[model samples]
Every structure is written in structure tokens, then in C-alpha cells.
Target: MNRVVVVGASAGGLSAAEALRRAGHEGTITLVGDEPQTPYDRPPLSKQLLGGDWEPDRLALRSGPDLDALALELRLGVPATALDPAARSVTLADGVRLEYDALVVATGVRARRLPGTDGVAGVHTLRTLQDALALRARLRAGRRLVVVGGGFLGTEVAAVARGLGVEVTLVEPAPVPLAPAIGEQAGRFLTRLHQENGVRVRVETAVGEVLSAEGAVTGVRLTDASVLPADEVLVAIGCVPNTEWLADSGLTVRDGLFCDEYCGAAPGVYGVGDVARWYNPLFGTDMRVEHRTNASEQAMAVARTLVGPGERRPFAPVPYFWSDQYGTRFQAYGHLRGHDEARVLDSDFAGRRLLVAYRTGDRIAGVLAAGVAPRPLRALRALVAARTPWEAALADPNAG
Candidate 1:
């Protein structure tokens, strides 16, 4: 490929651009970003940044000299408006069209917002740096904050607000937080974690509407007709992949940009990170991972495929993700979602330590642990990566 155009300026996009240079792609590299600022780490936006523990500058993925070393043509503040795969051209919002021999779609995803929340002050979604700053400004010692959605993002924000002395009320539509993703046992543990940290946990209820006054959020009305008066509200329901630009680009755009095992969407076009729901050979399924680790790893895989001197290799990886709440960390390896069975391998509720293994059919599909030693967790991760049989994994002495 003589020229490469990578759309999106987030972790995955930046990684792909850097990896291309590292892989000896001495061609024209254009990194297009919708946001004006240079790429910044996103995981910290919800934790350290929103908690006022870290400044914006700390989130920078690369410094001036570091980014300069890559010799990238940075195109910031202009969003890709459309894509023409046959022409191999990307049209930006500024009317600038970039043509490339190879293209990488890494636009990632945008946080889903609650209906009728537009233009409402005191309402927030933690997706970007600016979103974190705005929400941080409203989080005060005596402020009341209601968090809709008890997923990883919502729970983390609730924990941070509680630590800042903000009264937090967490509402979830599930019987327990993270039950659908992680099993009910593990989800209940997280529920206790939030409740113990002074967060009011409301389960099995959805938000009817966001109440507003004078063009600002005053509270939220729940499906039960109950109102939660709050100084701030964060809707951490979920995210939607940024695939609108590729609507008519002749690529399969289902939940995300559909890709093959090699991460190829079209002939010379590939997708990575949250925007790509590619097939994973490891688990024999298709998944789009939104974790920080997967972004860099998958981008590196695509880089190899793009500038390879040999045959193309499939981008297969054992997906991993973690969440930090109230000084405790929860880590999971492999595919935890859609597991048929979940068994608690180890537990110490009073000590706040637990290890759970999720099984899909007869194989150990995933593992989740908190307060467990790193050594044992690594061993469990190996089992999941190897797709160990359910009974065999349980028989192993180090399984716990």
C-alpha cells in the first residue's frame, strides 16, 4: 500500500497508524479524527479524570515529540462524512477527500444518550475528555447524582462520586447490575460493592424520562413513577458504533462493521476496535471488543496484515477487560458474555475476594476474579485461552 488513511483518532486508530510506521510502511499516512485534540486515553476518563484525581494532560497518549517521531499527517477536528470503497476515498466533513491504497476504519463508538436529554445541563455521558470534565465540575461534596445504568461505566462513576462525598443513586433495569454480561452471582457481588460504598442501588427499573426545568436537568422519573432529585445525572446505558458514515459504503454494517477472520471488511479495507465486529477464530465466534487492550492488539494484527512480507494471519485474541471501583479491581479474561453456566471457583465474601469461572457448553469460556492473586488469575486465564473442558478445568488443582 502506497498511501494509508485511518479514520478515527482514538486508541485503535492511533495504534494502527503507529504500527504501520513500525512495520516499515514508508508511505503517506493520514490520521483523521473527529475530535480536535490529539488522541487521549479513554478508560481513565471515567475513573481518574471524573474523580478530579488526574488532569487532562495526563491522559495524552503521546507527547509532541513522540507523535512527531511517527511522522503522521494529523487531520484533527474533521469527521469522516462518507466513504467510497470502490474509489478508495474518504470524504470528511470539511469537504476534504482523502484517497488511499489501504484504509482502516477505527471510528470506535459514541455513548448512547437517553431520549430528550439533548441540550440539558447537569446531564452527562462519559465518552470523551470533555464529557468527563463537565461531569466533574458538577460533582461536589453535597451534590446528589443519579446514575442510570449499572454497567461497568455507571458503577465506576457511582463509586467515584461516592468517594467525592456525592450522594449517588444507581438505577438498573436488570435484577442486578452486570447480570446479563456477567452472571447473577458476580453481579450481586458488584451490587454489594456499590451499596457498601454508599451508593443507593435500585434494580429492575428503567428511567421513564429525564425531568428538566429552565433547560437544565432537575431529576429523573423512573418507570415506577418515582422521581430522583439530583444535581447531576449520568446515562451510561451503552454505546453505539460510529458506522453512519459507512451506511452506503457497500460494507456489511450490522451492529458494527462486519469483518472476516483477517479483519478485512473489503479487499483493501479493514476494520478494528469497537467499530469492527469481526470473526474470532480463538472462540469460534464473532465479537467486537471495546477494551483498551484489544484496541492496540487488534490494530497491531491489522498492521501486520497490511504491510506483511508473508501470508495474512487471522486477528484472534482472548478478549480481556477490567473495571476499578472503590479501590477494588475486577478483571475478566475470555468471552464472559452468553456463557451457559457460571460456577464460583473460590469465594471469601467478608474479605471481598472471589473467583468465578463461566462455562459455555462443555468448555471453560471465561473467568472473572476480584481480590484474587495475580498468579492464580494468570493460571485461570491460560485455561480459558486453551478452551479447557469444564470438568477437566475443575479437576485442575490450580483452577481456583
Candidate 2:
């Protein structure tokens, strides 16, 4: 427990590193990241920072001096290429090998690119600070922005584009945006919301190829042979877990690196955040949460497991995520997937109300509301933790 190493520059990786040091490891701590710059906050990159309303420094969760003050050996700009479980060592991209007593894999994920869109200029994805910078510069007024995929990122970017006075068209292959997680009813309502706010939404519209003119994006040609003109295109299709570097490694990796409840992958190696898949006894499944809360909780768990455990907290933190669209703050608690029914606890969907979600044959599963007070959300977290029955929670005791 003297020395610990964490890999990844994403939220989970950074959180894990900071948690280990703050918990008084009193030993050598190293943070290795693949991305060149120091670890920066990502969620804001899609909202405030990319929207040109916030400075780049505002996107940083912690600064360089902060890492030094915490006494961490931050190996920034280096990515781990391989893992040796038997020898307890990691191979960096620069052919340097480092050994550690314990390791935490928080390598997060990378955005999936369009097959033929790479050579096309003006096509972009917003997963990193660099990507945001490039896209922000292109957010000029009168520009026609076509956002591929109607997921959270695409929708959020559309909102920003519209706000910047750019003509935006969102192309989604799904029947509706967020229909997979939030249900079709909710997704339909959201679609209307977007259209009302000046975003042109196209459902079940697949982009066959990103049209290019002189090596730069001109528009997108849909599967139906219709061509939609655009000056810039944002691809927010999805993300891939950064577990490829461990292909030859001993640890098992499916969608993400598999780990136990303690965030430990092997005896000493741990995994967290978007690159981790851990069993949640509460949910009776292997949960791989991709939220800032997961990063903080998993890092704390990994830190406790590495250092001597005095008193520890469980890894059963209720997952939480938030999104900003059209100047409204949206928040969610608990897992949204695997839910059978959604109950309107105390929400006026027309005017930003709290919506409580429940799982089939069980208790509350998730929550969604517009601008709810922080206090009630905490109570809902308690209810979700206690596995509170939905029927009683439906009465809306202190609606959030």
C-alpha cells in the first residue's frame, strides 16, 4: 500500500488519483494519462466551454499546482499500452515500464468516428478539450450545423448552436432521441421541445456519408439519398471503452474492464469509471456507470482498497448525471436503464417538473426533474438507497 498508480485522464481516473492522495496514502502516487494536456473536466466542454460562454481554464477540475500540492507524480501525456499482472507492471506508449503495488484503470472512453468522415474536414466530435476548441471556432452565426446522432451530446450541442444563431439540424437514427433510456413518450416530448427552440430534428434519419467539398464538410447525404446541406457536422454517435490497450493483458475486458465491488480488477489492480464494469448487488447486475459521481465513488473505493482500510464506504453510490439545454439544468439520480415504468411523481412536464421513475416489480429506479431543489433530490437518493416502494414514493413526499 506504499505506492499506487492510476491510469486515465478522464473524470474517473482523475478522481481516483486525487482520492488516493487525499486519504493520506503518505506514499508515492503516480497518475498516467494518454491525453497530452493535464486532466480537464469534460461535461462542461459540451455545454458552457464549447458554447463560448466559459473559459477553458474554467473546465479544469484541478490544476497542475494542485497535483503538485497533493504530492502526485503526474505522468501526463503518456498512455499505458500494456499491463503485466504477474509482474505488477505497466508499459507506457514511450516503451517505459513502471511497476506499482496497486493499479486503477480509469481510462474512460473514446468517441466512435464515422467510417468515411475522417478525411472530411469540418466534421467533429466533442469528447476532449481539443475537439471542443475546434468545434467552438466553427460555431459562427449563419453556419448550418448538422449534428449526427440525437443523444445527449448531440442535443446539447444543438442547443448551443441555436443559441449562437446557427441553423442546426439534428439527424438521429433512433425513432426518437433518448428513447432507449428515457422511453419514447419522454423522448417525443423532448423532440417537441427541441423543435420549439429552433432545432430541426430528423428521427430515423441515418447519415450514409458526410459529404465533402475540397476536403472539407459541405453536408450530409442520408440513407434515403436526400442531401442535407451543412457547413459543419458534429458526430455524437457513441463512445468506445479504452480497454484496447489491455488486449494482451491478463485482465478480462468485455465492454469495459471487469472488476469487483471494491473496484479491484485482480488482486491489486482496480478499474473505475467508463472503463470499468462492476457488479452492483443492489441492481443485481454488472453496472458500468459513466457519470462524475461514479468517478468520485470508484476512486474513493480504489483508494480505500489500496491504502489500509480504516473505515470505508460502500460502492453502491446512486448514479447521478446532469445536462444543460436551453438554459435549463437537467439532473438524474439512480440507474435509468432496466426500468419498466416511469411514474410522474410531481412533474409538470410542460413547465419543468420533477419526474420519478420506478422499476418493474421493485422500487424506485431513477429520477428526472427540471430545476428541483437540492434538498429533495438528497431525500430521493435516500429513498433510492432504501429501495423505497414506488407506490408510496408516487405520493410525492417532498417532491423534488
Candidate 3:
């Protein structure tokens, strides 16, 4: 492969480019991104960046010297408008066509915006750097904020707003926040975590409409017709894949671009990050993970496959993610959904530390730990990857 193109400039695409160079592939590598700025870490956009603890330059994933060393041809601030797999080329927004002998499709997802909030002022969604900067400015003291949805993003935003002394009300239609991902018990635990930090938690409630006054958002009307006044609102329901450009590209794209266990989309083409739904033989299922760890892992695997002949490896990862909020760090590993049982491994009341294990049949399916030091939890990843018995996982901690 003498010419390669890596689309998208986020974690997955950037990792793919770097991995190719590291693998000693002497190819002309081109990295295309929609953002004007250099690749940056996104998880901080909701925490450190939005909380005003970090500056824009601090989020950069690569410095000028770093990119110069890689010698990657960068096409920033221009989005890919269309893809032609048969022609082995991609069309940019400005009508420039980039041909590639191999391609890495890492065009990740975008934030799902709420209806009727597009043109309205005082409404925000935190997906990009600009969004975070604007939101941080509005999170002044004495401001009342309403956050729609109770997912990690919304919950994190609410936590940061409260820390800024902004009165925050987090509304979720589900009885407990993050119940779908972390189970009801753990979700309820997080709900209390936020409430204890001075955030108003409204469970089993949904927003019917955004209430605006004189072309600016004043509040939101609940399903029960009650209104919660707010100086600003953040809609963080979820994200959708940026896969529209691949319409006629002949790649299987439903919720995301479909890939095999090796992250292969088609011949000389691959997918990674939130935009790729790949199968995992270990779990006997297909999943699309948006976490940063999965993105880097998948990209590296794909890059190696592209660089070396017959060096392909299946992308089987022990799913892991971490979130920091209100001075507490929440970490989890493995698949949590469809588990048959859940058990608390450790609960240190004085230390505010808690650990829980999830099991599917006799095998441990997942593990979640809050306020628990990562030094101890690192062992849980290997345990989950090995499909160890839940009893063994519970006992291993005590042995340590």
C-alpha cells in the first residue's frame, strides 16, 4: 500500500495514522478532519474543558512537531462529502478528490441535537471544542441550567455546572440514570451521587418542549406540563454516526459502518471508533462502543493489518471506560448488559469506595468500581477477559 487515507481526525483515525507510521509503512498517509484545529481529546470537553480547568491548547493530541515527524498530509476543516469504494477515492466538501490504495473509515459520530433548539439562543450541546467553550462561559454563578437526558454526558455536564455554582436540574425519563448501561442499582447510586453534590435529580420525567422567551430559551416544559425555569439548556440525549457520506460507497451501514471481527469493512478498507459496529467472538455478539479506549485499540489493530501482509488480528477488547465527576472516579470493564446476576464485591462506607461484579451464568460479565483505586481494579480487566468465575473474581480481591 503506497497511498493511504485516514478519514476523521479524532482518536480512532489519528491512532490509525500513527500506528501505520510506527509499523514502518513507507506510504503517503493523508489524514482528513472536519475540525480546523489539530486532533484533541474529547472526554475533557465535558469535564476539564467545560469546567474551565483546562485550556484549548491542553486538549491537543499532537503538537506541530509531532505531526511534522509523522509527515502526514493533513486536510483539516474540510469534511468528506462522499465516498466511492469502487473508485478507491473520497470527495471532500470543497470538491477535492483523494484517492487511496487503502482507507481507514474513522468518521465518528456527532451529537444528536434536540428538535426546535437549532436557532434558539441559550441552548447548547457539547460535542466539539467550540461547544465546550460556549457552555463554560454560560455556566456562571447564579445561572439556572436544565440538562436533558441522564446519560454520562448529561450527568457530567450537570456535575460541572453545579461545581460552577450554577443551579442545575437533571431530567431523565428513566427511573434511574444510566440504568440501561450500568443496571438499575448502579444507576440509582449515581443518581444519589449527583443529588448529594447539589444537583436536582428529576427521575421518570421527560421534556416535552423547550420553552423560549423573546427568541431565547427560558426553560423546558415537562411531560406533565410543568416548567423548569433555566437560564440555559443542554441537550445531551446521545449521538448519531456520521455515515451519510458512505451512502453509495457499498459498505454495510445501519447504525454504523459494519465490520468483521478484524475491523475489516471491505477489501483495503476498515472502520473504527463510534462509527464502526464490529463483532466480538468472545462475547458472541456485535457491538458499537464509543469509549476512547476501544477507538485507539481498534485503530491500532486495523493499522497493523494494513501495514503487514498476513498480520491481521481479531479486535477483541476487554471493554473499559472511566468517568470523573464530583471528585469521584467511576470505572467499569466488560459487558454489563444482559447479565443474569450482580453482586457487590466491596463497599467501604468510610472511604466512599464501592465495587460490583456482574455475571452471566457462571462467568463474570462485567465489573464496576467507584472511588476505588485503579491499581486494584486493573486486575479485574484481565479477570473479565479470561471469563473467570464470578466467585473467583470476588475472592481475588480479598486475597490481595
Candidate 4:
């Protein structure tokens, strides 16, 4: 392979570029992205960036010298329009076509906007640096805010807004927020955490419509016919994989770019980050993870397969993710769903240091905990990965 083309400029894409050089692939490298600016970290966008503690430069994933040293032909601020696997070429929006020996698609995802919310002032979704900056401007003290959806993004945004002294009302249609990811018990705990932090938690409720007047958001009408007035509204339903550009690309795409265990989308084309959905033999499912760790790990894996000589190991990862909300850090590993049993390890609910272990049949399936030490977290992750017996994991003192 003499030339490599990496689409997307976020964490996964940039990491792939660096990984290529590390693997001794001294060939023409092109890093393309739709965003105008250089690659930057996104996790902090919802936390410190919105909290006003971190500057824009702190989010820089790579310095100019660092990027220049890689000799990457950067095509920023423009998106890829189409892909031709037969020709091994990518078409950009400007009609320019670039051929490559290997292609890495890391386009990631975009925040899903709610219906009847577009073109309305004071309505927002945080996905990019620009989105964060715009939303941060409205996270003022004494302002009334309504955050729709109770997923991580919505919950985190509500947490930040509450810390900023903004009166926040978080609405979720589900019985509990984050129930799909962390289980109903943990979800209810998170709901209570938000309430204790002065955020009005509305569960089993949906946003019927976004009430607006004079082209600005006025409030939100709930499914129960109750209205919560708001100065600004944040739509945090979730995100959609950015794979529309690959519609006719001949690669299988279902919600995300479908790839094999080696992250191979086609013969020479690969996928990574949020846009890639690959089967995980470990988890027994095909997952498209949007976490930062997955992006970084998968990018390196794909790069090695493209440049480094080796037997291609399947990309089977023990899924992990963390969230920081209102001074509490919540972390989880493994698949929390399909577990038949959940057992508590530590029972200090008042101190907010709680730990829970999930079991599928006799084997441990997952772990969810807050305010726990790294030692226990690591042990839990190991146990889940190894599919350790439930009794052995429960008896491990460090697991608490």
C-alpha cells in the first residue's frame, strides 16, 4: 500500500493517521474531515468546556507541529460525498476524487435533533466544539432550561447547567433515565442524583412539542399536558452515525458501516469510530460504540492491520465508558443488558459510593458503580472479560 486516505478528523481518524506512521507506513497519507478546525477532544466539550473551566486550546488533540510531522494532506471543513470501492477512490463534496491503496472511514456520528425544533432560537444539541460554545453561552445563572432526553449527553448537560445556577428541567419518556445502558436501578439512582442537585426530574414523560414564539423557544409541552417554561432547550435524544455519504459505496451499512471482526468494511476499505458497526465475539453482538476509548482502540487496531504485519486479531473489546455528573463519576464495563441478576457489592447509598455486579446465568456479565476506587473497577472489568463465576467475583474483596 503506497497511499492511505483516512476520512473523518476526530479522535479515531487522527489516531489512525498517527498509528499509520508508528506502524512504519511511510506513504502518502490524507486526513479528511467535515469540521473546519484541527482535530480536538470531544469528551470535555460537555463538561469543562461548558463549565467554563477549560479554554478552547485545552481540547486540542494534536499541536500543529505534531500534525505537520505526520505529513498528512489535511482536507478539513468539507465532507466526503461518495465512495467507490472498485476504484478505491473517495469523492468529496467539491467533486475531487482521491485514490488510495487503503481507506479508513471514521466519520463518527451527529447529534439527533428532535422534530419541530429546527430554525428555532435557543434550541441546541451538543456534539461539536461549535455546538458546545453555542450552548454554553446560554447556560447562565437564573435562566430556565429544559433538556429533552435522559441519556448521557442530556444528563451531563443538565448537570452542567445546574452547576451553572441555571434552573433545569430534564424530561425523559422512559420510566428512568439511562435504563437502557445502566439498568433501571442505576437509572433511577441517576434520576435521584439529578433531583438532589436541584434539577427537576420528569420521568415517564415525553416532550409533545417544543413551544416557541417569535422564533425563540418559550417552553416545552409535556405528554401529560403540562408545560415547563424555558429560556433555552437542549435536545439530547442521541446521535446518528454519519454514513449517508457512503449510501451507494457498496459497503454494507445498517445504522453504521457494517464491518467484519477485523474492522474490514470491504476488501481494502475499513471502518472505525461511531460510524463502524463490527461484530464482537466477546459481547455476542454487533455494536457501534460511541465512546472515546472505543474510538482510540479501534483506530489503532485498524491502523496495525493496514500497515503492521501480523495475524489480524478480531476486534473484541470489553466495552467500557464513564460519565462525570455533578461531582459524581459513574463508570461501567461489559454488556449490562441481558443479565438475569444484579447484586450489590457496597451499600453506602448515603455516601454515594455504590457498587453493583450483574450476572448472566453463572457467569458475571457486567458491573456498574460510582465513587469506587480503580482497584475494584479493574477487578470487575477483568472478571467480566474472563466470564468469571458469580461466586468467585462476589467473594473477591477488591471487587467492592
- lDDT by residue for model 3 over 1-400, one digit each (tens)? 8999999999999999999999998879999999998889999999999988899999999899998999999999999999898899999999999999999999999999988788899999989999999989888999999999899999999999999999999999988899888887778788888888899989888999999988999999999888999899999899999999999888899899999999888988899899999998777678899899999999999988988859777888888888988888888899887888767777764476778788888888888998877676777777888888878877785412
lDDT of every model, 2 decimals: 0.92, 0.81, 0.89, 0.90
By TM-score, the better pick of 2 and 4 is 4
- Cα error of candidate 2 at position 54, Å: 1.7
After aligning candidate 4 to the native by TM-score, how far in Å is the CA of 388 from where it should be?
Answer: 2.0
Cα deviation of 9, candidate 1, in Å:
0.6
Q: Over 4 Å off in model 4, which ranges?
A: none
For model 2 the local lDDT of residue 40 reads: 81
**For each candidate, C-alpha RMSD in Å?**
0.8, 1.8, 1.6, 1.3
Residue 67 of model 3, lDDT score: 86
Pick by TM-score: 1 or 3, better one: 1
TM-score of each: 0.99, 0.95, 0.96, 0.97
Model 2 CA RMSD to the hidden true structure, in angstroms: 1.8
Which pairs of residues collide in model 4? none
Cα lDDT tens digits, model 2, 1-400, are 7777888877777777777777777877788998877778888888888888898888777876786787778787888999998898999999998898888888998899999877688999888899999999999899999999998889999998899999999998888898887766657756777898999988887999888889999899999788999999999998899998899887889899998766668978888888899887666678887777778778877777666566544577678888788867778887787688876555555675545565646688777766667878777777777777877665556645
Alpha-carbon shift of residue 282 in model 2 (angstroms): 1.9
- For model 4, residues 8-105, the per-residue Cα lDDT tens digits are 99999999999999989899999999999999999999999999999899999999999989999999998999999999999999889999999999
Full-model lDDT, candidate 1: 0.92
Please provide, for model 1 over 1-400, each residue's C-alpha lDDT reduced to its tens digit, 9 standing for 90 to 100: 7899999898999999999999999998899999999999999999999888899999999999999998899999999999999999999998999999999999999999998899999999999988999999889899999999999999999999999999999999999899989999999998998888789999889999898899988899999999999889999999999999999898999899999999999989999898999999888999989899999998999999899938688887889999998888999999999999999988887888989999988999999999999988998889888989999988888888
Lowest summed lDDT over 10 consecutive residues: which window, candidate 2? 352-361
